[model samples]
Target chain A: MTTAADSTVQSAPVRPFAQALKDAQTRITTHMDARLGGDDALHAAMRYAVTGGKMLRGFLVLESARLHGVAEAATLEAALAIECIHAYSLVHDDLPCMDDDDLRRGQPTVHRKWDESMAVLAGDSLQTFAFELLADPRIGPHGLTLIRGLAQASGKDGMVSGQMLDIAAETATRPLDLEQITHLQNRKTGCLISWSATAGAVMAGADEAPLRRYADALGLAFQIADDILDVEGDAAKVGKAVRKDADAGKATFVSLLGLDAAKKRAKTLMEQACDALTPYGDAAETLKDTARFVISRDS
Target chain B: MTTAADSTVQSAPVRPFAQALKDAQTRITTHMDARLGGDDALHAAMRYAVTGGKMLRGFLVLESARLHGVAEAATLEAALAIECIHAYSLVHDDLPCMDDDDLRRGQPTVHRKWDESMAVLAGDSLQTFAFELLADPRIGPHGLTLIRGLAQASGKDGMVSGQMLDIAAETATRPLDLEQITHLQNRKTGCLISWSATAGAVMAGADEAPLRRYADALGLAFQIADDILDVEGDAAKVGKAVRKDADAGKATFVSLLGLDAAKKRAKTLMEQACDALTPYGDAAETLKDTARFVISRDS
Candidate 1:
C-alpha cells in the first residue's frame, strides 16, 4: 500500500519538514524496492535490512537535489544510493565481529534473523548495489564524481577509518580524547551526511562550497545529537540499546563534552548549519529546517 | 623488487604465457600498491591481503584489454579494481564465519594476522576501493558500464550467490548434483572471471559475444581444474590447505564427475575457449594461451 509520505511527494512541494522527510523515505524506499525486488531469499534479506530506517541520509539527498533543481528521477536514484550505503553500513556494523548487536530498529539484526554468512553476503551485496545505483547512466557524467565521493566518504579515509578507531579504542589503555572522538564521529557519521548534503551541488556542477560548509556543521551536530540521545533515549522508543558507549567507557560527545555542553554545542552548530545555507536563501528552506530537526529528533 | 613478470609486459608482444601472467601480476600489484599507499593500518591490511595471489583474474583483464587495444593505463586500473574485489572476497571468505580457512597463499589470513573486525573492515574497504577505482574518470563514459557490470558480477546474483549456495550445501541432506554444482561454480567462480575476460570488449564497446562464449567455458574449466588440484595438489605449492572440499564431503566437480572425467571435461572446455577466440585470431593468442594455462596450472 502507498504511504502518506509517498503521496505527499507525488503531490508536490512545500510540505512540513517532518512530512517532507517521511515523503523522501517513502519515495526512496519505493525506489529501493524496485531496485531490489526479487522473490529470492537474498532479496528478502536485503529489503528487510533496508526497511525501518528514518531515511535521514536519503532526505538529505532529496533536499539537496531539490534545492539544486535536479530532476526527481535522477535525484531519487542518488537518494537510493546513499540510503543503500547507509543501510549496508548498519548491516555490517551489526555483524557478530563488529558491534554484535542483536536488535536494530526494533527488529532482529540481519545476522540474527538469518545466518552470519548470509548477513555477510547480504551486506556485501547491498554495498555493491549502492555503487550499481550510482553507475546508472541517468546520473550523467558528473555521477562519476558522486560515485568517487561516496567511495572516499564510505571507504578507508572516512567511515571505515572511524570504525577502526572506535574498535581500537575498545582495547586501548587510555580513553580517546575530545579530538579523537570528534575525528571518529566525523568519519563514522559525518562523512556520509556531508556527502548526502553536498550531492545536489555535485550533480548540478554548482559551487559545493556552501553545501559543504552547511554539511560540515550539520554532520557534527547530528552526531552530537546522537550522543545526547544515547544518554537520554529510552530503548523502547530508540529501538536499540542506548548508553552502551558510556557503559563501555568509550569516548563520545557526551562523555567528552558532558551532556549539557554537548547539547549547547549541537545547538550552536545547528545554527551554523542554517547560516551556511544563506547563499541559497529561500531556496534552502527545507535544508534549514532539516538542520533544526537534526538536533530535535527523538529517534 | 621487480619480478620476471614485470619485465615481460614492459618489453613487448608474445611473451611466454608464464611470463605474460607474471607481468600482469607485477603491473597490477604495482598499481594496487600505489593506490593503497596510505600509512594507516587499514592500508597495510589491504596491501597484505591483495598481495601474493597468482593474480590470474587480473591477468585475464589485462590480456583481454590488451587484445582490444585499450590503453595500458586504463586497463591497469580495471585490473586493480578486479584484484581489489578478489582480495576482498578472499579476506571475507577466510573469516571465522565463512570458509574459516586459516591459511591463504601460504600465509596467515587477514583475520588471523590482525583480528576478525579488522579483516571485516579491511575486506569491506577493499570492495569499496574497487568501485572507486572504476569510477576514475580515466575509465571514461564506459566506466559506468564497467562499474555496473562489476556490481552485477560481484553482488547477489553473481559471486555472493555462489557463496551462499556453497554455505547452504554444508548442511543439506542431499549432495548437489553435477548440474547444481555447475550452476554454483558458475556464479561463485565464473562470474568475476567472465567479467574480467569480457572487460576489454566492454571498454571498447566492441562485440562481447565471442569473449563471453570463451569465458563461459573457461570459467567452468578453471573450477574443474581447481577441484582436481584440491585432490591431487600439494598444500605447500597450492598455497592453502588442499583436499578440504573432499574431506568435508562437498559435492565438487571432482566428487560428482570423478577426477579423470572432470579433467577431461576441463580439457574439452579449454578447447572450446580457444575456439571461441577464432574471431580475434592471432590478436587473442595471449588469451588462448591463458585458457590453456587455466587447465594446466598448479595453483
Candidate 2:
C-alpha cells in the first residue's frame, strides 16, 4: 500500500516538498497507530480524527529537527504530538456549538461519524496524549521546556484565547479590522505553527530566535493561503467547504485586503520567512521549499 | 470574607479535615486567580469552572506532599493542576451531549451559565492549563515524570476511557456486574485520585507503594459513598441532584450491593485506606481522617 511519495522519502535525503509532506504523514500515522492501538471507541475516534490531514505542522517539526541535528526519533514523536493537538482542535471546532462543519479532510467530522460525546472525549484525550508524548524521555532534558512552551502556545493565553476571540467576533457589531484579525489568527493558528517550527531548537538547547522569526512569517502566509483557498479553490480539492466565511459575511484576509492584495501579501510573507532562514544557508533548502509550498498549495 | 474553617487551617496543623479542605480551596483559588489573570470570557469561564469544588483532590496533593517533605510552594501548583483537570472533566461531562447535568456544586453548569462553545473552550483550556502548572520549574526536575504520570492517568487509557464506558453503559442491554462496575469505577474516578495521592512520592522520587495502596481503597470508598449519597442524601447537602441514577435505572454500587452492604463495604475500604497509611504513623492522621471523611460525609 506504499505510495510513490513514501518510497521516494524512504530512498533518499533529497525529497521534494510533496514527498516530504507525504513521508511525514505516513510516519506520524504509523507512529500514532502503534501508540494508540486498542478497540475502544474513544481510541478509534481519536485515530480517525488524527488521520487524513496534510501534516504540515509535522513536516515543520521533522525539517526543523533535521536542521538542528536532532534525531528523527524525538522529532517524530513531537511531530505526532502537534498533529494530535491540531486534530483535537479541529474535532472540537467542528462541534455543533462551534464552527459546525460537517466535513473535514473529505470525511465526516468526528461528531457526524460517531457522536458528539465521542468527539468530546476523543478530543480531550488527544490533547492529554500530546502532553504525554512530549514528556517522553527520548525528548531529553528539554522535555519540560517543550511542554511549557506548548502549554503556553496552545492554552488559555494562546490558541484557546484565539478561538474565544473568533467566536466573539462572529457576534460583534462589525467585521474585525486587519489588526484584530491578525492577532486572532496568530493565536488560533500561528502559535502552534510557531511552536512546531521552533521545537527542534528547543530540543537541541540552541537559540530558537531564527526559527521563531521564520515561523511567524510562515504561519501568517499559510493562513492567508487558507483564506485564498476558501475563496477560490474547489471543495473537492480543498477537502472541506469553501466560501463559508464570505457567505456568513465574516471578514478574512481575502475580504479585508482584496483577493489580489492578499495573495501578494502572502508572497511577501513567504519571502520574509525564507529570508529568516538565511542563517542556515543552503542547509535550509527544504524549509525554503516548504515556505514556497505554503503560499502555493490549494489545500 | 474569611470563614472559621479558613482561619483554623492557616493557624495550625492540628486543624480538622473540614478546615483543611477549606484552606486548600482558598489557597488553590487564590493561586489560580493569580495565574489566570485575564478578563477574557474563556479565562473567566476557566476560573469559574475551577472554583467551588470540595477541593478533596487538592487536599490529597497537599497532604501527600507534606508527608514526603515536598514544599507547599511546589505542591500547591500541583494541587491546582489536579483541580483544573477535575474541573475540566466535570464541565465536559455536564454537556448536553454527555451527562446533560444542569447543576454541579449547587451552581449552573458551564454550558448553562455561558454556552456550549464557551464550556467546550473553557474545559479545553483548563486541561492545557493543568500541564502548564506542572511544567513550572518549582516542581523540580521531576516535572516531566509528574506530567507524564498526569497525562497517562487522565488520558485515553484512563479517565477518558472510563467516561466512554459510562456512556456506552447507558444503552447496554444488561446492567454491568460488580466486576465490571469495579473496573469501570477504577478507571473513572480512581485514576486521578490515585495520581493525586501518589504525586508527593513521584515528586520526591520516593517509593509510592503505600500511597498507591491507600488510594486504591480510598478511591473505591469515595465512589461507594457517592452512590450512597445518590440514594440517601438531600440535593441541598449533596450540591447536585440526588437519586438521578435510580431515576434513570442506572446500575450503581448501591443498586447492586443494597444500601446496608454498600455502606459496610465503604466502611471496610475506609479502614483499609487508613491501614495502608500505618508507615507514616501519627504524621498520617490527616490522611486517615480523609479516608474516614470519604465514606462518612454527606457529599
Candidate 3:
C-alpha cells in the first residue's frame, strides 16, 4: 500500500543540501540584521556572535518545517531563534571561565574581541532574543509551545545540565565511562538538536516521534563525528583547535570507543537517522543528505 | 464625581503593605521551590541566587494583577518569573567579569558559593526558566504578551543595554552627566519595573497608562533611593557593600545632586509615583505604600 510519505516523496522535488543550507543561513542572517539594527556596541557584538556559523541546526528547522507544511515566515523565525541560542552557547562556552577558547568560527571569540563583560552581556542578550523571536505573532498559535520547548531543550535540564556534567567530569578523579560520556553528550549537544528536528512537527501540531527518533540518532552521530574530527581533521578545516580534546585527556567517543570503532558507530547512527526519516520519504532527501554530511564534514 | 478609580479605592479594602509583601514572597518562593526541585549543582545555585532578595518585583506583579482581577495562580507564576529574571541579572552582574561583588543579600554570591562556570550556567538557566514560566498555560492567553514584554524589557535594548552603558561609564574620561545617567538608569532598572507594574493591565487587556506612569516615577525614585542608600546605608542593613559608588567615583544622583537634594528629589518622585495610582484609588493603597517605601527603606 502506498503511504502518505511515499506520495510526498514523489510530489516534492528535492533541493540540493548545500543550496538549502545556504538559503537558511542567508535568510536567518537577514532576519536577524533587520531585528538587531541598533548602532550600540551591544547590538554589534550580538550580530557578531551569530555570524559565520554552519547554520546546520537552522537548516534542520527550515527543512523539517517544509516537510510539515509550516509557514516559511514562522519557520525562518524559528530558524533564527535556534541560531541565536547556538551562538549564545558558543559565546559562553568560549568564555575564560569555561572552555577558554580563543577562536570560534575562524575569528577571535566574543570575549577576546571585546571584554569578558561584553561577551557575558552579549550571550545573555542573545538568549533572551531567542525567546523574544519565538514570541512574535508570526509564529502562529504554537508560539508558546515552541517557546516552552526551546526553554526545556536549552535550559537547566537540557543543554545547561549537559554543560555542568561536562565541567564536573573535567575534574573527576577518573575519566568518564562510555555511559556517562553518552549521557553528557546527550545533554550537552543532543537536546538542542532534538528540539530543532522536532520543532516543525510541534509547529504543525503533528506527531513528533519520528523526528525525535531521527534527531536522537543524528545528534549522537554528529557528536561522534566531532570526536573523529578532533583527532584526525586539520585545524584549519575544522576551524578550531583540533586534538585539544585528546590533549586535555577528555573522554570523548574516540577516546572511549577507539577511532575506528567510533567512525563505524557514527556511520551506523547516520544510517539509523536516515531510516527514521522514511515517513517523509523522498521529501526528506535533503535531511538524509544532512545526516550524511554531519558525519562526513570536517567542520 | 465618582470615577472607576475612586470606586475601586472605596470598594477594595486595603491590605497592609507588609502583609501583602510577605504573602507575595511566600507564594513566589513556594512556587519556585516546587518548580526547581532538582538537587543538581545548577539547580542549587539557581535556588540560592533567587533567595534572600526583597521580592519587591514579585510583589509588584502580584499587586498589579490583583488590581486588575487577574487570576491569582497565573499572577503568582508571573511574579516568580520576574523574580527569576531579577535574580539571574544579580547573579550575572556579580560575576568577576562584571561588578565582581562577593556578597549579595547578606549571603555569598553564586560564584563565590560555587564557581564561575556554575554561576554562568545557573544565571543562564534562570533567565531561560523565567521565559519558560511565562510561557505556561497557567499564565492565560496573555502569556505571549507577557513573554514578549519581558524579552523587550530585559534583553539587549533594555536591562542589558543599561548594564553596557554603566560599564562604559566606568572607563569614560568624565563621569556621566545628569541626562546620560538618567538614560542609563532608565534602561538598567526602569524597564523591568515598568513591565512588572503594567503586567496586570496587559493581562486583563486594560489600559496600562496609569500603571506605566506610576512605574516610571517609582523606578526613577527607586534608583535615586539606591544612590542615597549607597552613601548613607550601613553595610549590615543594606546587605551588601555601601558607598562603593562614591569610592569608585561613579556618578550617581547623590553625588551629582548632593545628598540632601537627592533625598528631596526621591521624595518628590515617590509622591509622583503615588499620585499616578489615583485611578486605582484605595485599591492602590498598598501600591502607594510601596511607593513610599521605595525611597524610605534602608536596603
| Candidate closest to the true structure, highest TM-score | 2
> Candidate 3: how large is its RMSD?
5.1
lDDT of 1 by residue, B131-171 (tens): 99998888766898999999999998899888988888889
Pairs of residues at least 3 apart in sequence or in different chains that clash in candidate 1: B5-B22, B5-B23
| Global fold similarity of model 3 (TM-score) | 0.95
Give per-residue lDDT, candidate 3, residue B220. Answer: 94
lDDT, residue B173, candidate 1: 100
C-alpha lDDT of all candidate models, in order: 0.86, 0.89, 0.89
For candidate 2, give the lDDT: 0.89
Candidate 2 residue spans exceeding 4 A from truth: A1-15, B1-15
Deviating ranges (above 4 Å) for candidate 3: A1-15, B1-15
DockQ of each: 0.76, 0.84, 0.82
What CAPRI grade goes to candidate 2?
high
Could you give the C-alpha RMSD of every candidate to the true structure, in order shown? Answer: 5.5, 5.1, 5.1
Residue range B213-270, candidate 3, lDDT tens digits? 9999999989998998898888998999999999999999988999888887887787
Instruction: Please give the interface root mean square deviation for model 1, in Å.
Output: 0.7
lDDT of 3 by residue, A213-296 (tens): 999999999999898889988888777789998999999999999988897788789778989999998898888877877887
Look at candidate 3 and give me any clashing residue pairs. Answer: B9-B282
